[model samples]
Target: MRTSIVAVLYVGGWALFAWLGDSWWQLLVAVALAVVFTQLGFLAHDLGHRQVFRTRRPSDIAGLIIGNFGVGLGWGWWTTKHNRHHANPNHEDHDPDVSPAVIVWSEDQVARSSGLPRFISKYQAFWFFPLLTLEAWHLHIASFKALLQPTAKRRGLELTLLVTHFVLYFGLVFAVLPFGKALLFLAVHQGLFGIYLGCSFAPNHKGMPILTKEDELDFLRKQVLTSRNVHGGLLTDVALGQLNYQIEHHLFPNMPAPNLRRAQPIVERYCQEIGVDYLQTGLVTSYGQALRHLHEVGAALREPTREPTR
Candidate 1:
C-alpha cells in the first residue's frame, strides 16, 4: 500500500514535469521525484532483504522493479554488495562501505593511502557531506560497471533493466523540457537524491567501532557495537525508512521494516543484559560523531609528529 503511493507519486512527478512549463515548478517536481525516488530505493532495500515476500523469487522481482526500473540502480549488484556489508559490518577490509577513497575509517587505511587519496583523507570529514552530492551519479556508473563485469551474475536481465531505466529516465526529461532545462532537472534530481541516500545510511555505521580482520567477537556483540540507532519518533522512522533501528536491523537483517521499531526494545534489553554497547543518539549527534571519527582517523596524516597508532 505504501509502495503503491510512492510509485504513483514517482510517475506523477514525471507527468507533471512534462506538462508544466520550464520554471520553478519543474525544479519542484525534480525535488519531489528525488524524495519519492529515495523512498522507493528504501523499499527496494527491504525487498533485497526478502522482507517484502515469503520467497526469494518474488522479492528479487520486486527489487528489480523498484530498484532497477524505478530507482535506476542495479538490484543484483546492490543485493550482493549489501549482503557482504551485512556479513561484515565494520570490518575495514571486508565491508565495502568502509572502503571509501575519500574517507578513511581506520588509521591503518589512512596510512596506506598515498598521493591524492592521502590528501583527501587528511580532511575527509569536511568534504564528506559535500562529496555525497555526487554519490547518486557515482552509484549509477558503479552499478553499470558492476553489472557489465564478466563475473557479474544475471548480466542480461540486469543490464536490460538498467538500460531501460536510462532510456526512460532521460527520454522523459528530454521530451518534457528543453535540453538546458533537462540538464538542470537531472542535476537537481540526482544531487538531492544522492545527499538523501547518503544521509540515511551514514548515521547507521559511520562512527561505530571498526573491527580488524584478526578481531574475534560474537555475532550479537559485533552487530550491536558496530551499529548506532538514531533516536526519533514516527517522522524519523518514515524518513530513514526504519533504519533508525540500525542495531536491531543489523542483528536481524531479515526482519521486516515495520517490525524493527517493535523489536527495538527487546534488542536493547538483550544488549543491556549481555553488557554490550548499544549506541543510540540523536541524528545530529550521530552525524557529529561520524565527522569527528573521520577527523580523528585522519589526524595523524595532518601531524607528522603524531604517532599513527594514536
Candidate 2:
C-alpha cells in the first residue's frame, strides 16, 4: 500500500518532468531519481525477503516488477545471490557480497588477486566511492549474464522484462532530451544510484568479521558478529531503508523494514545476555571502519615485494 503510493508518485513525477522537456536542470532531477532508485532498491530487497508478502509467488511477482521492470535489475538473479548472503552472512567461501573482485575483502583474497585487481587493492579504500560509480553498470551486466545461463529460472520472463526496461528507459530519455543532455542525465542518474545503494549496503557488513568454514559459529552469532548497525534517527532510517539496524535485519530477514528499529533493542539485549559483541556506530564511523578494513586487507600488497634469495 505505502510502496504502491511511492511507486505511483515516482512514475507520475518522472513523467511530469520528462514531459516538461529537456533542460540543463534535469540533471538535478537525475540526482533526485538516484535517491529514489536506492529507496526502490531497498523496497525490492524487502520484497525479496518476503517482508511485504508472505507467499513466494506474490513476493516474486512484486520483486520482478520492482526490480526487473522498475529498476532494470534482475529479480531472480539478485534474490538468488542475496539469499546466499543471508545464509552465510560474511563467510569468505559462501557469501557473494564479499567475494574477491575489484576489491579484495580478506588477506587470502589479496594473495589470489593479480594484475589490475591486485594493484587496485593497494589503494582501494581511497578508490571505493569513485569505483562505486560503475556499480550500477556492473549489476546490469551481471543481470544479463545471469539470465543467459541455462539454469536461470524463468529465464524468458526475466530476459523480456530486462530488455523492455532498457528499451523504455533509453527511449524515454532520448525522446525527451537532447543527445548530450540525455547522456549526462544517464551518467548522473546511474552513477549516483550506484553510490547511494553502495553506501547503504557497505556499512552493514564491510568492516565486520569475515567468516570461513573453519569458524563454527551458531546462526545467531554468525549473523550478529558479522553485521554492524548504524546509529541515527528518522532521516537515517528513511535514507538507509532501516538497514541502519543491520544486526536486527540480518537476524530477522523477513521482518519489515519499519519493524527493524523496534527489534533492535530486544536483539541487542539478547546479544548482551549471550556475551556477543554488538557493534553499533555512527554512519561516518561505520564507513571509516569499512574503509579501514579495506586498507588493512591490502596492506600486504602495499609492502615492498621481496626479492628471492639465491
Best by lDDT: 2
Counting clashing residue pairs in each candidate, in order, gives 0, 0
- Tens-place lDDT digits, model 2, residues 102-161: 888988888888887888888899999999999999999999999999999999999999
RMSD of 1: 1.3
The deviation in Å at residue 34 for candidate 2 is 0.8
TM-scores, all candidates, are: 0.97, 0.96
Candidate-wise lDDT, in order: 0.89, 0.90
lDDT of 1 by residue, 198-233 (tens): 999999999889999788988888788899999889
Which runs in model 1 stand beyond 4 Å of their true positions? none
Clash pairs, candidate 1, are none
